[model samples]
Target: MIRTLAFLVLLAGPAMAQDPAEAAQTAAARLDSAATMLAEARSGEARVDALTETVRAYEDGLSALRQGLRQAAIRQRQIELDFDARSGEVSRLLGVLSTLSAAPTPLLMLHPSGATGTARSGMILSDVTPALQAEAEELRARLEELALLQSLQENAAETLEEGLAGAQEARAALSEAIGERTDLPRRFVEDRVSMAALVASSDTLQGFASGLAMTVAADGEAPPPDASAFRGELPLPVDGTILRRYGETDAAGIERPGWVLATRPRALVTAPAAATIRYTGPLLDYGNVVIVEPAPDTLFVFAGLSETYGRAGEVVPQGAPLGLMGGETGEVQAILSESAEGVDAPRSETLYVEVREGQDTADPASWFSAEMRSTQ
Candidate 1:
């Protein structure tokens, strides 16, 4: 955990652009806080809770590292501009020093005319030299800063690779812990043949959603958990920043009415609240979509997952492992803030979440915790 924290701190160094040095220091302090929890967890007491917290810490740290890397690239360009601006000052300082060094001390003392002239010349040089020296020191400081910035960028890049690997390992451990437990009562079992036919006939997501709702109701199974109790209090399925919020327009010129979360590659996903899996499979352009119902008139749609768990009939408690994002390196090249065009490299993995009440779209932001809402 300490190793993970260290790499994260290195990656966070560049983001505090106002004070990169201070940012690094702050990151270290934050890591210390995380480390304290890890040490307490090592006592073997509350192993499950400890492991879960550990995974969350690593996930948070990995997110910080990614943000730092993006800032580092911008800082590098700023440093180049600063170096260019200081070049003339550095050259002038060097010229002044070269001129002073050419003459011997004895010659400077005994000027061409007399002692009076020598004294006057000495006074002028003494006064001018200090100013020149000050300029030189300022230039040197900027040069040092440039070097430090370069080092920070290099270290962040290397640490990012290591952090991704460590984070993924921790995610796998958490997944196993979550998958082992499934105590939610089963409500209904989906018939594959019927579901396939319903899916084939439905022309839109809304149509499919409406049909699924009616099917669950007809089964006369016990109602799923009352997720309304968690309105604005539920946690996200994965630890990440909301890249795009409900009703936000993306660069593709399409307005999205769901929450889009940018997560690490292969990151484990969980059920935000207790729900029965209504449907789980590929849909249109959504990649792999999972529809879960936590209560009557409340259906949660999770899309863009690469691997899914549980069939259409299983009930999962809040926080149960659901699926994972795709990709090997866990690195994304573009975000919702940027256009996908010209991005030949693999983009970041995203999870699209839509909360629905009947046929109307509900704002997902109102379904998450207060702390998470602040992040959005």
Candidate 2:
């Protein structure tokens, strides 16, 4: 019995220090917060902003759920491996305990070495029984935890589905609100005919931008607020990874004076600082584009959006929604399965950012804060 228990203890290995339950609780809290935000978005006065926030909350919640599920899967696998390795030993230990329990008391008391041997055996059994009990309790706890983690993953599927739906709904509402919105202060009205002519005449983005800079407001609207103070302190317009730096050559051997960011499908793009919309429409080879001027002779150009928001010459506040990247959001099952298999959801859309000061194109990396870059 002593040998069997010792063997079992050796096979049990080290206890898992990290708690999956805590991770599950944290994920649950994030999901709850997302749900609350979704509810508020439905009735919020600033529907566009509220819905944008709601979509962000859902994205966060879904990310947390994926992480939590991954951790739980890892913990579950470890526990299962431990149990599989110790199964034979545990069964033998149980058999020995059962035999001892069923044996006659007189037979148990009797020993070849008489009372002294019996007393020693009793003392050893007393110690061994508690250790065995402790081992059993630990195994039971592990089994319980495994069941809980499994249940958590199972329930997470539904939660993930709900979160995906909520995010889609919010994004749709935000887009609709943007289309209907007309209250933004306009600095000037763009001349569509002149802009079209400029677009046709200009061969390079620089030429187009230079022509745009020369445009004057017929209504004499005040210039956009000075953004020089916020230089090197602005947040990124979108959450993404820097795919290519300014002037980086691509596979086609083409070098562009802009940063290309890899972002998830439908990721929100916002204004990095208070800026006037210089242009918002398709231009040249770039898809839908948004050009905003934050200060005199300074332009921030965002390209490759699936949709553009606001309008030309409108002053948008910092963090205002500018647009969304294109691509379909991943299905909940696909996301969960990928998470369980330790695969990260891919960033399927790209956004191009360019900072132009006067006629010179500056590196966007120098304009954004280090902390903001680090997160990307």
Worst 10 residues of 1 by lDDT: 336-345
Candidate 1 lDDT by residue in tens digits, 273-332:
888888888886788988898877788999999977666767776766677788775343
* Top candidate when judged by TM-score against the true structure: 2
Clash number by candidate, in order: 1, 0
How do the residues 203-289 of candidate 2 rate in per-residue lDDT, one tens digit apiece? 888999999854544543656667888888888898888889999999999899999999889888988888998888888999899
Local distance difference test values of all predictions, in order: 0.65, 0.74
Name the TM-score of candidate 2. Answer: 0.82
RMSD, every candidate, angstroms: 6.1, 7.9
